[model samples]
Target: MQLKSLRMLEAVCDTGSFGAAAQLLHTVQSNVTAHVKKLEEETGAQLLERASPVHPTPAGRLLLEHARHMLRTHDLALAQLQGLDPQGASQVAGTLRIGSMETTAALRLPVLLAQLRRQHPGIDLELEAQPTAALLEALMAGRIDCAFVNGAAPHSGLQSWPVFREELVLVSGQPLTRFPTPQEFCASVFLAFRQGCSYRQRVELLMASQGVTAVRIMELGMLDTILGCVAAGMGYALLSRALVEAQQQRFGVHWISLPPGLAEEFAWVDTCFVTGSVAGWSPALRAFAQLLGIHAQAIAAGEHVRPGPAQRVHRRQAEPMPA
Candidate 1:
């Protein structure tokens, strides 16, 4: 069938909603529904199972996989053709769909995006923020061009570039004088993002290492919500020090440095830029990677990213004591 129909099918499957697929495609809901229905009629099989959030049927899934392959091939062909341009200055213009973790979106991407826009005025950027695993899935499925996420770069059919290392801090509503003992730590509820969040996973490991048997976990969906809950003394959260410091005034939470042992073990997470080689390299993607390299170089040169005034004020509120 037509490539447009296949593209619509893949979008609907990825979004799990026809309406969302339409939004993604910059079309209307009825058009997305009609495209899928036409495909079903032509194939003589039902493709999607109707539900609140629809799911692809077995037949639909098979088509979706093929659709991904075809679309990736098409994108690669376009990228290669563009790369062949003798005039290199015009090669960097295209749509770049990027996925990211909420933490990175909140703390790091605004400046980078602004710079990108200024440098490549012809490029169009679309961003979606999700947990690391979800972003990886989107990248693999050709839903997004690339993703910025935490932890070691995933090895399967993907390439990764180390963007930066994030220093994590444990934050609480009440002031914590010393690092909490395992029992004390596990006593309070742990507020965190849903499953697959690297920060949540790391905190769990930290507690387990300290001989903690169990912990209470509250899964909050958004970063700001977690911060609000932690600041209200509802629970504690683990977040990038940069994020916590940036919003310190709004949340009024205290950041606790871990004991040297724990700090040494769980203090940082590497943020990596990941993309699938199967989809080939778009000029937009290459440009973004190049921009990341410039920043990574500065970090490698031992340049300290100075803390903002709010973070400086918070640090001065108490003498620096080892957790």
Candidate 2:
């Protein structure tokens, strides 16, 4: 009946444990149990089976199916009301071009865009989704204003700020205990990305260092193709944890953290064409910064699994502008 009860039910079914659900919901186990019991009583049916991993009863299963839609609807209603409220300023509008990697476009950007749409009704946002290398190239060419790319992309004419570091996870159909060491990686058929990918080079180096010569490899330019290959039990590849985890449900794959841990560093790159406007800053930029703030907060809250880098390496700085 209540959204709180629906949320508790959803969490219980998903987590398969009262304690886990309560933890995720930031309450005690008893509170979650009480909500579940309340819902069961109201519905006049058992909502869950108290087993090792919680299994939802039939009525609960139906609610679980509808939970996502319900939650989305609730958020939408809240956002619309907030947007129209006198306390909320609603004049922000205009087209905002954002360039981002396919990976980030999948993981990070969607939530930002949704919030942006509800909060700033005037902004029309467009995306240029490409691989990291191409996106950087376009960014330098003034094709896109800003982007989040996988790996470290060096551009001579822009200022790069560390957005965050993303771990490159090795996901396969099953656990990779058989390929325990880095040496085994070289022997296995290594899946690779297009030339100029920083991750591909790291994978090669990891393989070649431990007597791994002449690795069998497959190069796929698109993320979907790469994921498809991995899901179908092809060769292994290195990819951003954010992107892989986003698609984990749709694709059946087990993850193994790479040894020494390969990681991709992201930067928010802005071009050298600074004018009087850039010096002053704009509201869209402010909104974008706000979005980045949300991102940083989410990361700090430990919503994502961040693995350490293979080794500490300084970011490449752009050339100094002529005075």
Candidate 3:
């Protein structure tokens, strides 16, 4: 059938009623009905169940699935063809949906997105903050165009590359001359994000490695809230050192690096950019990937990278620790 027919079919499936679909597609109900009817006649299969909120038949569901892929391909082609800059880079002019962890968004994306916005004024950037696991779920479901996730290994149907290596630190409200033992640390309440948070998961694993089990956890949704609780001596939290350091002045939290062995293994978390295979190579995504690649490469080459607002505060160069 025609592309317009597939668009009508998709709108119907999404909106769940002929009238709603017609309104959404900016056409009359008769046109929507006609398109679906034409598709059914051409395919010789019943397409939809005539329900209140219309349900797709098995055949309709199959076509609708392919319709989504085809539409994505069609839109991507148009964007790529029309949105190129004179400098040979993709002029990102459409919406770019990005999912990220709050920490990564806070520490890493600000500068990157600022530069992008300046370079491509036409791009409309959309951001959603979630735990890495949640971000991955959204990416897989096509809800987000790409995600900035915490350390992960390769997986099927997705591609990921390192953006930065971030140091995870144990944070507390008060400055400590001596760090607690693993058992002692586990006894303290853990302030963290919800269950799916990668930093929280790493904390659990690190504690478990020391035979610390049945630890108490407090689910604090916002980073500022969690840090506030920590400043009140509520509990300890595992977070990017950069994040804690950035707010150390406000929160008066102290950070401690992990011991050598565990630090070598779990202390450093890789922030990665992930996308599904289909959208991974989109020009908008490619531009972002190139930026990250250049940054990572510069760091790897041991160049003296100037610190930005979102930069990792190097532990070796001490800032005055908050009392």
* Model 2: per-residue Cα lDDT over 57-173, one tens digit each: 887788778876787678655544343322354555445667765666666678878888887776688887665677777767766666666533455355444455566667776
List where candidate 2 sits over 4 angstroms from the true fold. Answer: 1-90, 150-153, 178-187, 260-282, 304-323
What digit string (tens of lDDT, one per residue) describes model 3 on residues 227-288?
99999999999998878888899888998888776776668766777777744456666666
Candidate 3 residue pairs that clash: none
Which 10-residue span in candidate 1 carries the lowest summed lDDT? 314-323
lDDT tens readout by residue for model 1, 1-323: 98899999999999999999999999999999999999999999999998978989999999899999998877755654474333333556778898999999988888888898898776799999898888888888889998998854566687776566677888999888887777787678889989988888887988888887587889998999999999999988889987898999998999987676666668756777787772476777777777767766676467464433433443355222111
lDDT of 1 at 116: 86
Best by lDDT: 1
Local distance difference test, each candidate: 0.80, 0.64, 0.79
Clash pairs, candidate 1, are none
Against the true structure, candidate 3 reaches a TM-score of 0.66
- For each candidate, what TM-score against the reference? 0.66, 0.57, 0.66
Clashing pairs counted in every model: 0, 2, 0
